[model samples]
Target: MATLPPGPVRLYGPQFEKDPGALYAEIRRQHGPVAPVLLEGEVPAWFVCGYREVHQVTTDSQLFARDTRRWNAWSQVPQDWPLAAYVVHNPSVMFTEGTEHRRRAGAISDALDAVDQFELSTQCERIADQLIDEFAGTGEADLMAQYAERIPLRAAVAMCGMPTADMPGMVRDLGLSIDSSGQESLDAYGRVQQAMARLVADKRVAPGPDVPSRLLQHPSGLTDDEIVLDLLVVMAAAHQPTTYWIGNTIRLMLTDVRFATTLSGGRASVGQALNEVLWQDTPTQNFIGRFATRDTRLGGQRIRTGDLLVLGLAAANNDPHVRKDAGGAVGNRAQMSFGHGEHGCPYPAPELAEVIARTSIEVLLDRLPDLMLAVPAESLTWRPSIWMRGLTSLPVRFTAV
Candidate 1:
């Protein structure tokens, strides 16, 4: 169990970015299910692409743990590594194990569970309507920048009871934290931590009806510091991924005639489009993922203790064996988009995201029934991060009314 040779398909570069789906299929064909992969900086890791292999790795938490400190490639990773903030171990629920993880995660679930779904959807509709009004009279809009990217952050900060005044800055900082690298990325992460810390402190002194307030009052006795960290996790989880889900769903609805022609009234179509995006263009395509606890073999690949395994979530969804058995992607909630097993997206989180995304799309279509792509679908470009699958912009036009 020593360092192996670098992978053939470098998971970066323009070629891979331009056509990642093709590269993923090629990797699967050439390297089998659990193939060797090179992360940024030519770091070696395992990419678990097969549906079954991903299932096994996720299900066996002991064998494949969430802790990143156990990763053996740290020696090879550079200090300036942009992704360092993501994998850095903290006392937050993300890096915790066993009882500790359950305690923290349970508090989160309870807090999220207390949210009234009926009210949440109503709130989402308001957020969506407000966003749409900004561009409704313009006759054309870049939905990604103007519409899709704005909704999730606004709704989430409102739900968390943060000041409306802080939102524009929060949106910018959160974007950098997710998309930036090097010192800039670290700076953005620090700013987010500071902001959440202030929120947690304020909530401790004066509580209210919001996620952070609930965490402050929960019986789990989360520390101010712990609440601060977990709040960052929850917000980051809630924001960018949910944003892309909205954007990707809209892109799907506008471009695909199958969806476009069917929307006399598209509550059902909205749900179908949302689910289908989870299968094809998952917001989080590849995850930083679990570390090997000990020596093991997965999908015939020899894995050393402390080796890193990047979960090829989107790839696994398109796995031929599973897709063949399941017939097709439509109506298949079985996809690993939100992930699976113990440390997955944690119950109420996924449900809330669906509420936000569904309402966002449904409202947009209602307000603009004639919504159609402003440019050829081929001209739409995806953002170039291997970890995220999202359009750079989705231009659309409708009658100004």
Candidate 2:
């Protein structure tokens, strides 16, 4: 077995957040496939960066598990620790394993599958146009805050059958949940949970042809708490990643001359640009806390039972073994952005998510064909997160329509 280095590499520092791709390249050069790293809260974990290794860890559920209850950090850390918020043991499908994982995941998948993709696409287009109309007269807007973020929330509200009146608050809570300070994050998480719980109750009392309602009807027999957490999972899964996806793809379209030329010349579609982003810069750069079920060897390193493993989705996607020509793999679906195996993304399958993102982008681009970045690309900043890779803002200017 390869010996782990003496000290854990800090993976959540400002430097790492500033340029993760460079950091990942250095790590791969120094540590091979699986590198030992420390999260922001000094949490020790292994980052699986090799494409084949990530696939093995993600698919071989028997060797590595998604259940946080198996995480050694839970026993070692205090309940009120800031990191505890992320590792909160919930009955949601995101944290389950084996049969329970399948049952809970199936409920979500069926609910999402029941949605009309055409209606969802139309709704996204309508929302995009409406949002664009808010800034059409101004000629300048922060697309990240004004458009990319809001469209997904609105679409999620419509799909989950939540009240539109609660959208502003939901948006605030969701943003806080992702980027807020310590205590504020906890408070924001509480509000989000309460809001989702209320939606569960409302859906139960008056079921509609929405995802939450369909989940309630699933034969999994999930409890009320389970249903609430699962609903939050759906909302988070649908809104945040999708939001980043739109922003990233739009950034690519606006800044990369290659993509701009292809899109303008009709040689490549918006779907193709979106796929390239998924392969090169996935929305969720890294995902949490898979625990080893037993003492095991992975990627030439020893993994103890309950040790944490973070799948480096972005790094794995860029792994040279799997991707020989990263720039040429346009429209490729082999990227691990949506993940793989039994615990892969269950809501808003890759195709449907792409449709929503593409529709929104198409509506905005068609309405303002002259859109260009207001600031230099290097001036833009990324959200400092261990789980997601998102721009803090994307400012753009376009001719008033």
Q: Evaluate residue 377 in candidate 1 and report its C-alpha lDDT on the 0 to 100 scale.
A: 91
Worst 10 residues of 1 by lDDT: 1-10
Estimate, for each residue in 149-191, the C-alpha lDDT of model 2 and write its tens digit: 8888778777887787997788788778766778897799899
* Candidate 1 wrongly placed segments (more than 4 Å): 1-8, 181-188, 325-328
Model 2 lowest lDDT segment of ten: 260-269
The residue-by-residue lDDT of candidate 1 on 1-401, one tens digit each, is 12223454577777668788887888888788988888888878889999899999989999999989999989999877756766889878888887888899999999999888888899889988988898999999999888878887777777788888887788788878876776797798889888888877888888999999999889999998988888788888887789899999988887888898866476779998999899888898988899999998999889999999999999999899877754466577988988887788888999999999999889988899888899999999988887889999898989987
TM-score of each: 0.94, 0.92
Clashing pairs for model 2 are: none
Stretches of candidate 2 off by over 4 Å are 1-7, 74-81, 182-184, 262-268
Give me the candidate number with maximum TM-score.
1
